[model samples]
Target chain A: GEEVAQTPKHLVRGEGQKAKLYCAPIKGHSYVFWYQQVLKNEFKFLISFQNENVFDETGMPKERFSAKCLPNSPCSLEIQATKLEDSAVYFCASSQSTSGGHNEQFFGPGTRLTVL
Target chain B: AQSVSQHNHHVILSEAASLELGCNYSYGGTVNLFWYVQYPGQHLQLLLKYFSGDPLVKGIKGFEAEFIKSKFSFNLRKPSVQWSDTAEYFCAVRAISSGSARQLTFGSGTQLTVLP
Candidate 1:
Protein backbone atom coordinates (compact mmCIF):
# COMPACT_ATOMS: atom_id res chain seq x y z
CA GLY A 1 0.00 0.00 0.00
CA GLU A 2 1.19 3.50 -0.76
CA GLU A 3 -0.62 5.17 2.10
CA VAL A 4 -0.89 4.41 5.78
CA ALA A 5 -4.14 2.70 6.68
CA GLN A 6 -6.18 2.84 9.88
CA THR A 7 -9.13 0.72 10.95
CA PRO A 8 -12.44 1.60 12.59
CA LYS A 9 -13.23 5.07 11.37
CA HIS A 10 -15.18 5.57 14.57
CA LEU A 11 -15.20 3.78 17.90
CA VAL A 12 -17.49 4.26 20.88
CA ARG A 13 -16.61 2.91 24.29
CA GLY A 14 -18.16 3.38 27.68
CA GLU A 15 -16.11 4.78 30.47
CA GLY A 16 -13.94 2.10 32.07
CA GLN A 17 -14.24 -0.04 28.96
CA LYS A 18 -11.38 -1.01 26.73
CA ALA A 19 -10.76 0.47 23.29
CA LYS A 20 -8.42 -0.65 20.58
CA LEU A 21 -7.25 0.87 17.29
CA TYR A 22 -5.23 -0.56 14.45
CA CYS A 23 -2.92 0.96 11.89
CA ALA A 24 -1.03 -0.43 8.93
CA PRO A 25 1.95 1.53 7.74
CA ILE A 26 2.96 1.98 4.14
CA LYS A 27 4.51 -1.01 2.45
CA GLY A 28 8.08 0.17 2.53
CA HIS A 29 8.00 2.42 5.55
CA SER A 30 9.94 1.36 8.62
CA TYR A 31 8.83 3.97 11.16
CA VAL A 32 5.31 4.09 12.55
CA PHE A 33 3.96 6.74 14.90
CA TRP A 34 0.74 7.29 16.78
CA TYR A 35 -0.73 10.60 17.81
CA GLN A 36 -3.81 11.70 19.71
CA GLN A 37 -5.80 14.69 18.51
CA VAL A 38 -7.97 16.14 21.24
CA LEU A 39 -10.42 19.01 21.28
CA LYS A 40 -9.17 22.24 19.75
CA ASN A 41 -7.10 20.11 17.38
CA GLU A 42 -4.08 19.73 19.59
CA PHE A 43 -1.97 16.77 18.51
CA LYS A 44 -0.07 14.83 21.14
CA PHE A 45 2.45 12.17 20.27
CA LEU A 46 1.69 8.80 21.84
CA ILE A 47 4.29 6.37 20.60
CA SER A 48 6.54 5.33 17.71
CA PHE A 49 7.98 2.10 16.33
CA GLN A 50 10.81 1.07 14.10
CA ASN A 51 10.23 -2.17 12.18
CA GLU A 52 8.19 -3.89 14.89
CA ASN A 53 10.45 -2.60 17.64
CA VAL A 54 9.55 0.09 20.11
CA PHE A 55 11.53 3.13 19.08
CA ASP A 56 10.08 5.51 21.64
CA GLU A 57 7.45 5.21 24.34
CA THR A 58 8.04 8.33 26.36
CA GLY A 59 4.77 9.87 25.27
CA MET A 60 2.65 6.83 26.12
CA PRO A 61 0.79 6.60 29.39
CA LYS A 62 2.21 3.56 31.12
CA GLU A 63 -0.76 2.83 33.32
CA ARG A 64 -3.49 2.08 30.78
CA PHE A 65 -2.13 2.76 27.34
CA SER A 66 -0.17 0.13 25.47
CA ALA A 67 0.88 -0.40 21.84
CA LYS A 68 2.53 -3.07 19.77
CA CYS A 69 3.89 -3.54 16.26
CA LEU A 70 4.51 -7.13 15.29
CA PRO A 71 5.85 -8.51 12.04
CA ASN A 72 3.22 -9.42 9.40
CA SER A 73 0.55 -7.58 11.36
CA PRO A 74 -0.80 -4.11 11.68
CA CYS A 75 0.24 -2.08 14.68
CA SER A 76 -2.22 -1.75 17.54
CA LEU A 77 -2.92 0.78 20.25
CA GLU A 78 -5.07 -0.25 23.16
CA ILE A 79 -6.46 1.79 25.99
CA GLN A 80 -7.78 0.11 29.06
CA ALA A 81 -10.40 1.68 31.37
CA THR A 82 -11.16 4.51 29.09
CA LYS A 83 -11.97 7.90 30.52
CA LEU A 84 -13.72 10.99 29.16
CA GLU A 85 -10.35 12.50 28.45
CA ASP A 86 -9.55 9.56 26.24
CA SER A 87 -12.11 10.60 23.64
CA ALA A 88 -10.11 11.80 20.70
CA VAL A 89 -9.04 11.08 17.16
CA TYR A 90 -6.13 8.70 16.96
CA PHE A 91 -3.88 9.20 13.95
CA CYS A 92 -1.23 6.83 12.68
CA ALA A 93 1.68 7.87 10.51
CA SER A 94 4.54 6.10 8.77
CA SER A 95 7.80 7.26 7.35
CA GLN A 96 10.93 5.92 5.77
CA SER A 97 14.01 5.37 7.88
CA THR A 98 15.26 8.65 9.36
CA SER A 99 18.90 7.77 9.40
CA GLY A 100 20.12 10.56 7.12
CA GLY A 101 17.70 13.32 8.20
CA HIS A 102 14.75 12.49 5.90
CA ASN A 103 11.69 12.27 8.15
CA GLU A 104 8.51 12.86 6.21
CA GLN A 105 5.57 11.11 7.82
CA PHE A 106 2.51 10.06 5.84
CA PHE A 107 -0.66 10.04 7.90
CA GLY A 108 -3.70 7.83 7.73
CA PRO A 109 -7.35 8.68 8.11
CA GLY A 110 -7.70 8.90 11.89
CA THR A 111 -10.04 6.85 14.00
CA ARG A 112 -12.37 8.92 16.11
CA LEU A 113 -12.82 7.43 19.57
CA THR A 114 -15.64 8.50 21.84
CA VAL A 115 -15.71 7.52 25.50
CA LEU A 116 -19.10 7.83 26.95
CA ALA B 1 11.04 19.29 25.49
CA GLN B 2 9.74 20.86 22.28
CA SER B 3 6.43 22.67 21.92
CA VAL B 4 4.77 24.36 18.93
CA SER B 5 2.40 27.29 19.00
CA GLN B 6 -0.07 28.38 16.32
CA HIS B 7 -1.39 31.78 17.28
CA ASN B 8 -4.29 31.86 14.87
CA HIS B 9 -7.06 29.61 16.02
CA HIS B 10 -9.33 30.50 13.14
CA VAL B 11 -8.83 32.56 10.00
CA ILE B 12 -11.47 33.74 7.56
CA LEU B 13 -10.69 35.08 4.10
CA SER B 14 -12.52 35.81 0.90
CA GLU B 15 -11.61 34.05 -2.30
CA ALA B 16 -8.43 35.32 -3.93
CA ALA B 17 -7.27 36.83 -0.66
CA SER B 18 -3.79 36.36 0.63
CA LEU B 19 -3.13 33.93 3.44
CA GLU B 20 -0.61 33.59 6.19
CA LEU B 21 -0.49 31.33 9.25
CA GLY B 22 1.97 31.89 12.02
CA CYS B 23 3.76 29.07 13.79
CA ASN B 24 6.50 29.18 16.40
CA TYR B 25 8.37 26.61 18.38
CA SER B 26 10.37 26.60 21.61
CA TYR B 27 13.50 24.56 21.07
CA GLY B 28 17.10 25.63 21.22
CA GLY B 29 18.57 22.81 19.22
CA THR B 30 18.41 22.19 15.49
CA VAL B 31 15.00 21.01 14.30
CA ASN B 32 12.97 19.82 11.35
CA LEU B 33 9.84 21.84 10.53
CA PHE B 34 6.75 20.80 8.63
CA TRP B 35 3.32 22.07 7.70
CA TYR B 36 0.36 19.77 7.23
CA VAL B 37 -3.14 20.45 5.98
CA GLN B 38 -6.36 18.58 6.68
CA TYR B 39 -9.47 19.23 4.68
CA PRO B 40 -12.91 18.48 6.04
CA GLY B 41 -13.47 14.74 6.54
CA GLN B 42 -10.00 13.97 5.20
CA HIS B 43 -6.70 12.93 6.66
CA LEU B 44 -3.69 15.15 7.06
CA GLN B 45 -1.44 15.88 4.06
CA LEU B 46 2.00 17.28 4.18
CA LEU B 47 2.16 20.79 2.75
CA LEU B 48 5.87 21.44 3.01
CA LYS B 49 8.90 20.61 5.10
CA TYR B 50 12.27 22.06 5.99
CA PHE B 51 14.98 19.61 6.94
CA SER B 52 17.97 21.71 6.04
CA GLY B 53 19.35 24.05 3.40
CA ASP B 54 16.75 26.43 1.98
CA PRO B 55 14.83 28.50 4.49
CA LEU B 56 11.92 28.84 2.08
CA VAL B 57 10.21 25.65 0.98
CA LYS B 58 7.38 25.22 -1.48
CA GLY B 59 4.63 22.62 -1.31
CA ILE B 60 1.72 21.45 -3.33
CA LYS B 61 -1.30 23.64 -4.13
CA GLY B 62 0.76 26.77 -4.19
CA PHE B 63 1.57 26.56 -0.50
CA GLU B 64 4.88 27.85 0.76
CA ALA B 65 6.55 28.22 4.14
CA GLU B 66 9.53 30.11 5.47
CA PHE B 67 11.62 28.80 8.33
CA ILE B 68 13.23 31.49 10.41
CA LYS B 69 15.86 29.95 12.60
CA SER B 70 16.43 33.11 14.60
CA LYS B 71 12.78 33.39 15.60
CA PHE B 72 12.19 29.68 15.78
CA SER B 73 9.24 30.15 13.49
CA PHE B 74 7.88 28.49 10.36
CA ASN B 75 5.14 30.55 8.82
CA LEU B 76 2.95 29.22 5.99
CA ARG B 77 1.84 31.58 3.26
CA LYS B 78 -0.05 31.69 0.00
CA PRO B 79 -0.35 34.52 -2.42
CA SER B 80 -4.02 33.82 -2.98
CA VAL B 81 -6.49 31.43 -1.42
CA GLN B 82 -9.50 29.73 -2.92
CA TRP B 83 -12.62 28.34 -1.37
CA SER B 84 -11.25 24.89 -1.94
CA ASP B 85 -8.37 25.76 0.30
CA THR B 86 -10.52 25.75 3.39
CA ALA B 87 -8.92 23.38 5.79
CA GLU B 88 -7.08 23.00 9.07
CA TYR B 89 -3.37 23.74 9.09
CA PHE B 90 -0.89 22.41 11.59
CA CYS B 91 2.77 23.15 12.16
CA ALA B 92 5.06 20.54 13.60
CA VAL B 93 8.66 20.28 14.75
CA ARG B 94 11.09 17.50 15.54
CA ALA B 95 14.39 17.87 17.32
CA ILE B 96 17.42 16.79 15.30
CA SER B 97 19.75 15.64 18.01
CA SER B 98 20.99 12.26 19.10
CA GLY B 99 18.82 10.24 21.48
CA SER B 100 15.76 12.17 20.35
CA ALA B 101 12.57 10.29 19.67
CA ARG B 102 12.21 12.00 16.28
CA GLN B 103 8.47 12.23 16.83
CA LEU B 104 6.71 15.34 15.69
CA THR B 105 5.42 17.90 18.17
CA PHE B 106 2.45 19.64 16.57
CA GLY B 107 0.74 22.91 17.27
CA SER B 108 -2.92 23.49 17.91
CA GLY B 109 -4.26 23.67 14.38
CA THR B 110 -5.53 26.78 12.66
CA GLN B 111 -8.80 26.46 10.88
CA LEU B 112 -8.92 28.35 7.58
CA THR B 113 -12.30 29.22 6.13
CA VAL B 114 -12.25 30.63 2.65
CA LEU B 115 -15.50 32.29 1.74
CA PRO B 116 -16.58 32.57 -1.85
Candidate 2:
Protein backbone atom coordinates (compact mmCIF):
# COMPACT_ATOMS: atom_id res chain seq x y z
CA GLY A 1 0.00 0.00 0.00
CA GLU A 2 3.00 2.28 0.08
CA GLU A 3 2.93 4.28 -3.14
CA VAL A 4 4.56 7.56 -4.10
CA ALA A 5 2.96 10.20 -6.26
CA GLN A 6 4.95 12.74 -8.25
CA THR A 7 3.41 15.75 -9.94
CA PRO A 8 4.32 17.62 -13.12
CA LYS A 9 4.89 14.65 -15.39
CA HIS A 10 6.90 16.82 -17.76
CA LEU A 11 8.79 20.07 -17.27
CA VAL A 12 10.71 22.29 -19.66
CA ARG A 13 13.07 24.85 -18.21
CA GLY A 14 15.71 27.15 -19.56
CA GLU A 15 19.29 27.39 -18.47
CA GLY A 16 19.73 29.27 -15.20
CA GLN A 17 16.06 28.82 -14.44
CA LYS A 18 14.60 26.93 -11.53
CA ALA A 19 12.77 23.61 -11.53
CA LYS A 20 10.78 22.21 -8.66
CA LEU A 21 9.54 18.60 -8.42
CA TYR A 22 6.94 17.42 -5.97
CA CYS A 23 6.21 14.05 -4.44
CA ALA A 24 3.45 12.90 -2.11
CA PRO A 25 4.41 9.86 -0.16
CA ILE A 26 1.98 7.24 1.03
CA LYS A 27 0.05 8.18 4.12
CA GLY A 28 1.64 7.14 7.43
CA HIS A 29 4.90 6.28 5.72
CA SER A 30 7.88 7.78 7.47
CA TYR A 31 10.56 7.55 4.81
CA VAL A 32 10.81 9.44 1.52
CA PHE A 33 13.53 9.22 -1.11
CA TRP A 34 14.52 11.06 -4.26
CA TYR A 35 16.55 9.79 -7.20
CA GLN A 36 17.82 11.17 -10.50
CA GLN A 37 18.23 9.19 -13.72
CA VAL A 38 20.26 11.03 -16.32
CA LEU A 39 20.64 9.88 -19.92
CA LYS A 40 18.94 6.63 -18.97
CA ASN A 41 22.05 5.57 -17.17
CA GLU A 42 21.25 4.84 -13.57
CA PHE A 43 19.09 5.88 -10.69
CA LYS A 44 21.22 7.77 -8.20
CA PHE A 45 20.01 8.55 -4.73
CA LEU A 46 19.60 12.26 -4.21
CA ILE A 47 18.29 12.48 -0.69
CA SER A 48 16.29 10.69 1.98
CA PHE A 49 13.99 12.10 4.61
CA GLN A 50 12.43 10.45 7.63
CA ASN A 51 9.42 12.24 8.99
CA GLU A 52 10.48 15.71 7.78
CA ASN A 53 14.04 15.17 8.99
CA VAL A 54 16.84 14.50 6.56
CA PHE A 55 18.36 11.11 7.20
CA ASP A 56 21.02 11.10 4.48
CA GLU A 57 21.83 13.61 1.75
CA THR A 58 25.38 12.86 0.78
CA GLY A 59 24.41 12.13 -2.83
CA MET A 60 22.67 15.45 -3.24
CA PRO A 61 24.41 18.36 -4.85
CA LYS A 62 25.20 20.91 -2.19
CA GLU A 63 25.05 24.17 -4.13
CA ARG A 64 22.06 24.11 -6.48
CA PHE A 65 19.87 21.30 -5.23
CA SER A 66 17.75 21.50 -2.09
CA ALA A 67 14.90 19.25 -0.95
CA LYS A 68 12.38 19.54 1.85
CA CYS A 69 9.46 17.55 3.18
CA LEU A 70 6.95 19.95 4.61
CA PRO A 71 4.38 19.08 7.23
CA ASN A 72 1.10 18.09 5.53
CA SER A 73 2.43 19.31 2.20
CA PRO A 74 4.21 16.87 -0.09
CA CYS A 75 7.98 16.67 -0.33
CA SER A 76 9.70 18.81 -2.92
CA LEU A 77 13.08 18.77 -4.62
CA GLU A 78 14.10 22.13 -6.03
CA ILE A 79 16.89 22.83 -8.44
CA GLN A 80 17.99 26.43 -8.84
CA ALA A 81 19.90 27.67 -11.88
CA THR A 82 19.37 24.48 -13.78
CA LYS A 83 21.97 23.50 -16.34
CA LEU A 84 21.87 21.30 -19.38
CA GLU A 85 23.42 18.53 -17.40
CA ASP A 86 20.66 18.80 -14.82
CA SER A 87 18.05 17.47 -17.19
CA ALA A 88 16.86 14.03 -16.17
CA VAL A 89 13.97 11.99 -14.80
CA TYR A 90 13.48 12.55 -11.09
CA PHE A 91 11.81 9.75 -9.15
CA CYS A 92 10.31 9.79 -5.67
CA ALA A 93 9.87 6.75 -3.48
CA SER A 94 8.47 5.93 -0.06
CA SER A 95 8.64 3.03 2.34
CA GLN A 96 6.91 1.96 5.52
CA SER A 97 9.24 0.42 8.07
CA THR A 98 7.81 -2.01 10.55
CA SER A 99 9.44 -4.22 13.14
CA GLY A 100 10.41 -7.17 10.95
CA GLY A 101 9.37 -7.12 7.33
CA HIS A 102 10.86 -6.50 3.95
CA ASN A 103 11.25 -2.74 3.73
CA GLU A 104 10.60 -2.38 0.02
CA GLN A 105 10.70 1.12 -1.40
CA PHE A 106 8.01 1.85 -3.92
CA PHE A 107 8.58 4.31 -6.76
CA GLY A 108 6.41 6.87 -8.50
CA PRO A 109 5.99 8.27 -11.96
CA GLY A 110 9.04 10.45 -12.43
CA THR A 111 9.09 14.11 -13.38
CA ARG A 112 10.93 14.44 -16.64
CA LEU A 113 12.95 17.64 -16.55
CA THR A 114 14.20 18.95 -19.88
CA VAL A 115 16.54 21.90 -19.85
CA LEU A 116 16.84 23.66 -23.16
CA ALA B 1 30.59 1.75 -0.33
CA GLN B 2 27.98 -0.33 -2.12
CA SER B 3 27.92 -0.68 -5.88
CA VAL B 4 25.79 -2.67 -8.33
CA SER B 5 26.61 -3.93 -11.78
CA GLN B 6 24.18 -4.93 -14.49
CA HIS B 7 25.63 -7.10 -17.25
CA ASN B 8 23.65 -5.70 -20.15
CA HIS B 9 22.83 -2.15 -21.08
CA HIS B 10 20.27 -3.08 -23.71
CA VAL B 11 18.80 -6.40 -24.77
CA ILE B 12 16.56 -7.15 -27.73
CA LEU B 13 14.52 -10.32 -27.60
CA SER B 14 11.66 -11.94 -29.43
CA GLU B 15 8.24 -12.46 -27.96
CA ALA B 16 7.61 -15.41 -25.64
CA ALA B 17 11.30 -15.88 -25.14
CA SER B 18 13.06 -16.54 -21.90
CA LEU B 19 14.96 -13.68 -20.26
CA GLU B 20 17.85 -13.58 -17.88
CA LEU B 21 19.20 -10.20 -16.92
CA GLY B 22 22.34 -10.50 -14.92
CA CYS B 23 22.84 -8.35 -11.83
CA ASN B 24 25.66 -8.44 -9.34
CA TYR B 25 26.74 -6.48 -6.30
CA SER B 26 29.96 -5.68 -4.51
CA TYR B 27 29.13 -6.08 -0.86
CA GLY B 28 30.34 -8.67 1.60
CA GLY B 29 27.73 -8.48 4.33
CA THR B 30 24.03 -8.99 4.73
CA VAL B 31 22.33 -7.10 1.92
CA ASN B 32 18.88 -6.62 0.48
CA LEU B 33 18.30 -6.68 -3.25
CA PHE B 34 15.41 -5.67 -5.50
CA TRP B 35 14.40 -5.40 -9.13
CA TYR B 36 12.33 -2.53 -10.47
CA VAL B 37 10.85 -1.91 -13.90
CA GLN B 38 9.75 1.17 -15.78
CA TYR B 39 7.61 1.07 -18.87
CA PRO B 40 8.03 3.46 -21.75
CA GLY B 41 5.69 6.11 -20.40
CA GLN B 42 4.85 4.83 -16.96
CA HIS B 43 6.18 4.89 -13.45
CA LEU B 44 8.74 2.58 -11.98
CA GLN B 45 7.21 -0.48 -10.33
CA LEU B 46 8.68 -3.12 -8.08
CA LEU B 47 9.21 -6.48 -9.71
CA LEU B 48 10.61 -8.42 -6.78
CA LYS B 49 12.86 -8.22 -3.76
CA TYR B 50 15.12 -10.41 -1.67
CA PHE B 51 15.72 -9.76 2.01
CA SER B 52 15.78 -13.14 3.72
CA GLY B 53 14.61 -16.77 3.52
CA ASP B 54 14.18 -18.36 0.11
CA PRO B 55 16.70 -17.37 -2.52
CA LEU B 56 14.11 -17.48 -5.29
CA VAL B 57 11.43 -14.79 -5.29
CA LYS B 58 8.46 -14.36 -7.56
CA GLY B 59 7.29 -10.92 -8.56
CA ILE B 60 4.39 -9.38 -10.36
CA LYS B 61 3.70 -10.03 -14.06
CA GLY B 62 5.21 -13.46 -14.15
CA PHE B 63 8.69 -12.22 -13.34
CA GLU B 64 11.08 -13.91 -10.97
CA ALA B 65 14.54 -13.26 -9.59
CA GLU B 66 16.99 -15.44 -7.73
CA PHE B 67 19.15 -14.11 -4.94
CA ILE B 68 22.39 -16.06 -4.85
CA LYS B 69 24.36 -15.13 -1.76
CA SER B 70 27.70 -16.71 -2.47
CA LYS B 71 27.70 -15.20 -5.96
CA PHE B 72 26.54 -11.80 -4.75
CA SER B 73 24.05 -11.80 -7.58
CA PHE B 74 20.31 -11.36 -7.97
CA ASN B 75 19.46 -12.10 -11.59
CA LEU B 76 15.95 -11.56 -12.88
CA ARG B 77 14.31 -14.18 -15.07
CA LYS B 78 11.12 -14.87 -16.96
CA PRO B 79 9.93 -17.95 -18.71
CA SER B 80 8.17 -16.14 -21.49
CA VAL B 81 8.50 -12.42 -21.96
CA GLN B 82 5.95 -10.56 -23.99
CA TRP B 83 6.07 -7.33 -25.93
CA SER B 84 4.73 -5.52 -22.90
CA ASP B 85 7.86 -6.51 -21.06
CA THR B 86 9.92 -4.09 -23.11
CA ALA B 87 11.11 -1.65 -20.52
CA GLU B 88 14.05 -0.50 -18.52
CA TYR B 89 14.93 -2.58 -15.48
CA PHE B 90 17.00 -1.52 -12.52
CA CYS B 91 18.84 -3.57 -9.94
CA ALA B 92 19.22 -2.07 -6.51
CA VAL B 93 20.87 -3.12 -3.27
CA ARG B 94 21.09 -1.76 0.21
CA ALA B 95 22.70 -2.83 3.43
CA ILE B 96 20.07 -4.02 5.85
CA SER B 97 21.32 -1.89 8.69
CA SER B 98 19.72 0.41 11.17
CA GLY B 99 22.24 3.13 10.51
CA SER B 100 21.06 6.45 9.24
CA ALA B 101 23.17 6.12 6.09
CA ARG B 102 21.52 3.00 4.80
CA GLN B 103 20.11 3.95 1.41
CA LEU B 104 19.32 1.91 -1.68
CA THR B 105 22.02 1.98 -4.31
CA PHE B 106 21.03 1.28 -7.90
CA GLY B 107 22.99 0.13 -10.89
CA SER B 108 23.08 1.30 -14.47
CA GLY B 109 19.81 -0.16 -15.74
CA THR B 110 19.33 -2.79 -18.42
CA GLN B 111 16.86 -1.87 -21.07
CA LEU B 112 14.92 -4.88 -22.35
CA THR B 113 13.43 -4.60 -25.80
CA VAL B 114 11.10 -7.48 -26.55
CA LEU B 115 10.51 -7.53 -30.26
CA PRO B 116 7.16 -8.58 -31.55
Q: Which candidate gets the maximum lDDT versus the true structure?
A: 1
| Best-fitting candidate, scored by DockQ | 1
lDDT of 2 by residue, A1-116 (tens): 35678989999999999999999998888889999989888888999998899989989998999999989999999999999999999999888857664677878888999999
TM-score of chain A of 2: 0.95
The 0-to-1 C-alpha lDDT of every candidate, in the order given, reads 0.93, 0.90
lDDT by residue for model 2 (B21-86), tens: 999999888898889998888887889988889999999999999998889999999999999999
Off by over 4 Å in 2: B99-101
Instruction: Extract clashing residue pairs from model 2.
Output: none
- Poorest stretch of ten by lDDT in candidate 2 chain A: A97-106
DockQ of each: 0.67, 0.60
DockQ, Cα level, model 1: 0.67
The deviation in Å at residue A86 for candidate 1 is: 0.6
